[model samples]
Target: MTATTSPRVGDEIGPLEVRATTLEDLVRWAGAIDDYSPIHFDPAAARDRGLPGVVVNGPWKAALLSRLLTDWLGESGTVTGLRCEYRRPDVVGGTVRARGVVSAVTRDGAYECVACEVWIEDGAGERTVVGTATLRTRRPETGGAPPADGHGRAALIGDRLRDALRVGAEAGRFTYRVEAGDLARFVHAVGGRPPAETVGTHVPPEAPPTYYAVLDPVERRELQLEELLDELPFAKTGGGNAFNEVEYERPIRVGDVLTVVTTYEEPYERDGRAGRLLFRVRRNDVFDADGHLVARSRMGHVLAYDLDRVAGR
Candidate 1:
């Protein structure tokens, strides 16, 4: 379990109770974070996109997987890394269960550590989100200039979208200070108990695992992806979060001001069940006010475009 009790390989974390997420729950989450699309709460909007119905938030699912790890570690440890992919969508009104099994356990200096393979499953017992998490006893605290300016990058879209996505293509940097009120609302939306504030002091017992999303905002960065696709070369189609991998230098305490520098990297095309898929990858590096690397996040998105248009139909 931690530095106290040995967590051996193959030890299980949970089969957290299969719980159905309600529309209100999704609203609470949407209000707390950036994922507020009609596809999350409107059935017709989902049907227009070929989904069976309204779907649960992918980041929310990632948070649930993180909870599985923290719930197992108790207060003795914190998750240092987590990576998850939404293999399949989970529709609203359906049940989701989380479980993890320790795959490796070792010692990192003074902290004991373990890695677990975790996933969320649907009622049919099929995995909807699958990933791995790394946990260690909390450790003490652990970027660079913004990439070359991006104003000239817009001319590089479409035929040269690949060029625009070349490694190190700067997407711009953003800054935010962690607020206890924001953290509390996010924790409650995910059904976690938030730490209480005393007088004017407010430090969470631990930062919520997936709160890093608030800092990244990868797809919506300087590129302003939506303003693209104005031409007939490719028509916009279905696209949203594809996956996310985050590594923390330390659990972010309240009031830490962070600036994240984002850049495009490893853009490529692959074939999915529908047809050709375009994947755009971004890396966000977060630094504290003192310029210490607080966290780094790499996020993948299924860029919206019609499959037929991509096929030259």
Candidate 2:
């Protein structure tokens, strides 16, 4: 419970000190990450979509989950890998907390590796996001094989949709300069350290694992969760991020220029509690100015629709 405490397998990470979600927080995230999906900002759009009100951004929650571990392990700690699922919607104006428990701890030479299972819970005691993360203390520099060609159930895919899908296609590539101010905004939006512009708070030397996802998409047409789904006619409607998995080779540091290339994996289908859902995956490979890999992230999105409505048309 103390700052000097050593995390054991059962030790609980903070139900991180957090505050209620707000419209301003969503706007900050949108500006910082380029995930300017209207559902996060416009309550009217959310209402039109049948949602009760504006909902928290899924990527924002993912950042908070990483914050739960990084904050617990202290600044020296680095998140090596993270995988989370958006299980439920957390509406704006509601308070949600992130918590985790150390699942495993091992020493690999100079680094102490810790694995944790983390989740976000609403005031009603329901989990809105759930996942696991692997972290390490005392960073060691230097990190996927590609997804199989046919990753999902191809048989279930409609011939027209299947043929139209751009599996294994390169979406886009661009260079993005890393800035401490952006990192500061992301961290502050997710309830971490104060803004870098603050008189006393210094710019973070390295960004947390989720930083790659929140990087500005200044030149790219597609946003983080929608990268792989772009250009598909069926996907033109809209969808929500289902899950995100990322692995880091090294922490992204301020002043580093990154060349990021993203590609599409196979598209698939699945039946869900609501209805038949379409799933798409996007993989992003980040390289430092030296051309070394920085991180690799695969994002999954679930798109629900009515075949009958289209067929009737």
Candidate 3:
């Protein structure tokens, strides 16, 4: 059924147990996503590149966190929002666990819950990925029924597209140290070395590729949905609602500091069968240590109440 069906916060949602982090696991993760860097495989290369051992991809940890939440909430639950900060590299052979605790519930006639924090911890109790999320469940008696207020459908649609109205810039700078293990894990996950004098070298002898998945300066990633919701005026008009569609621009390498800057470029409104729909567009720029542009990404959010219905029954 659904997480809301349970109706309690402290209840144990689920647990992710960890075993030895293997090279094969790393390779499979990166290859599946088409990321290939040498540090994951060659020990000598890793040594030359100045890492203790192999490192794991930061996004993999984020994915694990996402899985933990979805599995705990049940198949019916949808991930409304997710924001992760990469603190430190998870090395090969290190054990980690993903855990969650119910933090708060927002009941506006119907119940919607927010998990304040979900984290991934290493064997020594060190956190790798720190983040938060939100989930919505249908009211029990009216499963699949229309909302009590006809405006619900229109509201959901409006919120999803409200991002287009935002205007201004948000910027932050983060620094992180690169270790050999971090590079190796990233290599295994994405596949291939960072282009080196010798094949099979775990670390690259020279600078790594722009697509390498390096640790950013911030130890804990922040998912500021509250701030984002506050910044956009449309979000306030119809009961703040939005949805995310994320895409990776490139891989981040180890020991590289990244400066992330974001801006609200445009906002637009459209009319649909349900009612009025709003759309918001935002852009993110990622820069390397030398202040050079590494990658750019654009994200759009759809604001509306009839999200499920719009998808088609």
What would the per-residue lDDT of candidate 1 be over residues 68-130, giving only the tens digit for each residue?
Answer: 787776666789999999999999889999989989888888776878899999988999999
- Cα lDDT of model 2 by residue, 130-229, tens digit: 9999987764332122236863422233443434444576666778888877777667667643354454666577987778776424213444333333
* Per-candidate local distance difference test: 0.75, 0.73, 0.57
Per-prediction TM-score: 0.45, 0.44, 0.42
> Model 2, stretches more than 4 Å misplaced?
1-5, 139-313
Q: Is candidate 2 or candidate 3 better by TM-score?
A: 2
Q: Is candidate 1 or candidate 3 better by TM-score?
A: 1
Residue 79, candidate 3: Cα error in Å is 1.1
Once fitted onto the true fold, the runs of candidate 1 whose alpha carbons sit more than 4 angstroms away are 1-159, 162-167, 192-205, 219-226, 230-232, 235-237, 304-313
Clashes of each: 1, 0, 61
Error of 2 at 51 (Å): 1.0
For residues 151-270, what per-residue lDDT tens digits would candidate 3 score against the true structure? 221222234434323355453444445555656655544564343433466556333453322322111234233234333323222322243333444455556566766555556667
Lowest summed lDDT over 10 consecutive residues: which window, candidate 2? Answer: 138-147
